[model samples]
Target: MKSKGFTLIELVVVIVILGILAATAVPKFINLQRDARIASLDGFVGALKAANSIVMSKATIVGIKSAKVETNIPNTDLYVLDGHMSIKPEHIKAAMNIEGFMVTNYALTMTRTTFVYLADKELTMPELRALNCFIHLTRSYTQQDGSNVIDTGDLKVNEFYDGC
Candidate 1:
């Protein structure tokens, strides 16, 4: 009588095929987290722009145009520099959800304000920036003759996610 069981070679071939399929798929799965982080950063940039728009509209309505004037959006503890939406944590948090995010550094003056991110709160700003996974937002006043302030609302945004 002929045996019905499969030969060892057939089983080994099946296992080899499965191994090849796994090898092809593993890398994609491994990069999902990175992709997600990068996408989130994109969304974050959009939110920042929206917040700035809101602040600008409020500033116009409130007539907060003086270069030395503090940005005052009523009913929020948030503040900006020179009537522009600053990169302050409080100012940003007012517009979007930043549950797990942490700010590494923030500085503000009458002429400019900057906000830098620490991808991880435990990591130093330099470490996070070296990984190319940080955001740097700056709002500054523009000068016409390198002396006279012409515009008080220019925002510069720099975001990186190569090492997300």
Candidate 2:
């Protein structure tokens, strides 16, 4: 008699192989989310830098305030472009809604400077532990020594903290 269809054993074997392949592939797909997060962060950093430079040169302090999502992109606000720069507002929204970003001020000058320190909202406890992931940007610059410089202002990405 000729076999009419795949045997039970053969079908079982095929199912096992498919299961193994799926098991291996699922984790990789899950990890992709983390990669996306890193990419978004990188983009945000670049945008912030661009915005800072533009505000420092061509715009005023009010220009920096327009760096929010609502001012630029409505609703989702994943990206905010203004002052000759585009920033990912979604990062800030994520940080705000998810508590993933924490803004800290590095007082280089006894008073507040034009730049604000931005970083991952969720940092390790003790504050000092998370001090490394800081990004600095100056929206305002003063002319000193016949040049425009942040001088007492700077931005940190915290990723470069402790030689990271």
Question: Which candidate's TM-score is highest?
Answer: 1
lDDT of 2: 0.44
Give lDDT tens digits, candidate 1, residues 17-129. 99999999999987997777767777777877777677777667766644354565667655555656666666677655665565534333444444444344546555765
Candidate 2: tens digits of C-alpha lDDT, residues 38-133: 565566667556545644343334444344222432333333333333223343433234234444444455222222223444443346344433
How does each model score on lDDT?
0.65, 0.44
TM-score of decoy 2: 0.44
In model 2, which regions exceed 4 Å deviation? Answer: 60-151, 160-164
TM-scores for every predicted model: 0.72, 0.44
Q: Report residue 16 deviation for candidate 2 (angstroms).
A: 1.2
In terms of lDDT, the best-performing candidate is: 1
The superposed Cα distance between candidate 2 and the true structure at residue 68, in angstroms, equals 23
The worst-scoring run of ten residues by lDDT in candidate 2 lies at 110-119
